[model samples]
Target chain A: MVTRSFPGRYDSLAQIGEFIRGITDKAGLNNFAAYTVEMAVDEACSNIIEHAYGAEDQGPITCTCKVNTKGLTIILEDRGRPFDPELVSEPDVTGELEDRPSHGLGLFFIRQWMDEVEFEFESGNGNRLTLYKKRTTASTKSTRQK
Target chain B: MEITHTQYKHCDLVKVKGRIDSYTAPQLAETFNKITDDGRFKIALEMSELDFMSSAGLRALINTQKVCKRYNRGELVLVAIPGNIHAALDLAGFIPLFKIFDDVLSAVGNF
Candidate 1:
């Protein structure tokens, strides 16, 4: 497992992307799979900076990447405002453009791209977002092709 | 993200390169705002070099599309979208919201 902490600010997003790409690439995830994981992590970190911390540079975002025989697991922890998923509905992706919203899609993408997503929050502790991605023989084969 | 504008006879082309996530989406949004403020509604976003985008980038596109489409003044079109960025547009159900083209000439001619 490799862990790193970054300041919860917009400027940290690029560094976060680099961190995820490096680990995902080293883990033998295919380009598409690695891209998906990178995008999901970006969405998760963006949400932490936007909603959880409630402001930029307000706290710290700790990210961990662990590789196992099964797949990869990523844990992101933040001490910002806790978010209740129940209150936020799936974004109306199929809705008319005029009726579309900007708020819910980040969380939606995080859930859609990752194989598993679990959110845990405590009042004094922090928000822990755990995401999983399964390794596949297809992914391995494709990586070898490159 | 870097955005460069090329003004056509009837349409304005905004070449967007680089990744637009939560951090750089505002730059794209600000670009659109500047275009609309200039009363140029017909705009084409060239995304040939775009490598990645998240929902924040989608938000910027939708917001600008809404503004350009208001009162049927004009519309925001997309040109030469990369494979990954195209998937993001498709996933967001934004494929049908704006007219998409494979090249810049066709997209600019659309205006």
Candidate 2:
């Protein structure tokens, strides 16, 4: 498991993606899976920065990734204001695009991209978003080619 | 992040360059609102030069798509979408919302 802390702000969110990339690259993860990991991880971190902290730059956002032969498990923990991503309802994108709202789609996208996404919240403090992605044969082959 | 706009006969082409994360997604959102709020639709977003996009950026696009579609007078075509944006769109199942094109000319021409 590798762990790193980043400032919970928009500018600092980029580091979340880079950190996931660094770990996945060293773990010999496949390109597509690596990209998926990066994207899902980024979505989690962005949520912390934007929603959890409300773009506050003073707080810390920590990410941990545990890698095994078959897959990667990532956990993002933040000590910002308490929020539950799982509770946010998915947007009604089925209707006219013009009538859609701008927000409430981040967690939906995160769930869609990651193989599995779960959430846990601590009372009056913060929350944790856990994500998992299993490595595939094609991903292994792509990693081997690298 | 940098954005350049070019107007054609039928639509406007807005080219975005750089990362669109939580920090910059608002810029994109503001631009979209300013341009399309007046109900002038048929805008083509040329995102080939865009290198990165986080969930905030996706939300901005989704919001803009909704607004543009509501006037029901025009369409928002995502033109020359970069591989990264394409991946994001695919993950969000938003690839079907826009009429995608390979190049700026084709996208604008289709309008």
Candidate 3:
């Protein structure tokens, strides 16, 4: 498992993305799988900064990723308000555009891309979100288009 | 993210390059507002060089599209979308929300 902590700021989003890219690269995930993981993590962390922490630079977000023969698991921890994305009900994704609610889309995408998503909260600490993506055709395939 | 504008006879073309996450989505929304504030409703977004876009970015586009499509005044169309973003749009069920095109000229001509 590789773990990294980031300042809960919007600017750190880019760095977080780079970090995930590196991890996915090292795991030899296919392009689509890597992109899925990247997008899921980005959405999760961004939601954390906006909702959990309620603002930028207000807390710390630690991300942990573990890749094994079967799948990849990611756990994100934030020392902020407990805004558990797992509690956000699934939105009406395929409904009419006018009928769709805007708030839950990020979480929806996260759920769609990941095989599993769960949340755990500590009493005096903070919120933890875990996501898993099963490897369908991976283990040694690089994401490169060569 | 960088936003550049080009005015056409029928619509305004907004070229966006770079990631559109929560941090930068507001800027994109503001850019659309500027166009609408100028009394232009029809807009074409050239996203050939776009690297990334999250749900926040989708929210910006959908909100603007709703405004432009209100009362049949105009609509927002997408042009030259990247593959990954196309997949994102597909997964979000956003493909049916706006008219997408292969190029800006076709999108501009649709107005």
Candidate 4:
């Protein structure tokens, strides 16, 4: 597992993206998987910054990326208030544009992009969200051919 | 980050020229929301100058698209999407979600 610490703020999003990109590239993920994983990972991390940390400009957010033959797994642990992904819901897109809200789509996009995701909490500990993306057969084949 | 705006006959062309990360995304969203809230639906966003974008930026654009689509008034077209934004959109399966154009004029012309 590779771990990198980031400031719990929006600017740290770039650093988070770079970290995920490095891990995915080493995992032999192609541009497509790389992009998807990065997007999903960024969304999850953004949720932590915005919701977990309440967009506070203080504290540190840590991301641990583990890669193996199966695929890539990223565990995002933040030292903020515990958050329940269950209570998090997708935004309703069917409503009128004027009446619509700009939030709630981050997790929805994560669910759509990532192969699997789970959320957990450790009492006084901060929230930990795990996101996993398996290497597609096509990607594996391409890697083998290379 | 740099932003340039060009007004067409029926719409506005906003070119975002930088990384739309978590911090800048809200600014972009706010700019877009101001436009949409004022009932300007026929809009084309020129992203050729954009270098990077986080999921927050993607959410902002998607949120704008949803707003435009909801009014049933006009369309939100992405014009000259740079390679990085294209890659991001492709990964998120958003290429088919918005009408794409090669140039801002072409995107605006469609409206």
Taking the candidates in order, what DockQ does each have?
Answer: 0.46, 0.39, 0.44, 0.34
Candidate 2 segments exceeding 4 Å error: A123-125, A137-146, B37-40
Candidate 4 CAPRI-style tier: acceptable
lDDT of 1 by residue, B1-111 (tens): 788998877989999988888889999999999999999899999998987888888888898999999999999999888765676677778888989898998998887
Which portions of model 4 miss their true places by more than 4 Å? A93-101, A137-146, B33-41, B49-55, B62-75, B81-98
Could you give candidate 3's per-residue lDDT for residues A1-146 as a string of tens digits?
A: 99999999988888898999898887777787888888999999998998889989898999999989788889999988878555778877688767867778888888888888998889788999999988874434334320
TM-score for each predicted model, relative to the true structure: 0.94, 0.84, 0.93, 0.78
DockQ ranking, best first: 1, 3, 2, 4
Taking the tens digit of each residue's C-alpha lDDT, what string does model 3 give over B18-84?
Answer: 8898888989999999999888999999999988898999999888888898888998999988887
| C-alpha lDDT of residue A35 in model 1 | 77
TM-score of chain B of each: 0.96, 0.92, 0.96, 0.93
- Where does model 3 sit among the CAPRI classes? acceptable
**Better model by TM-score: candidate 3 vs candidate 4:** 3
Indicate the residue-level lDDT of B55 in model 4: 63
Clashing pairs in 1: A52-A81
Clashing pairs in 2: A97-B66, A98-B66, A98-B70
What's the TM for model 2?
Answer: 0.84
* DockQ value for model 3: 0.44
Candidate 2's displacement at residue B94, Å, is 2.4
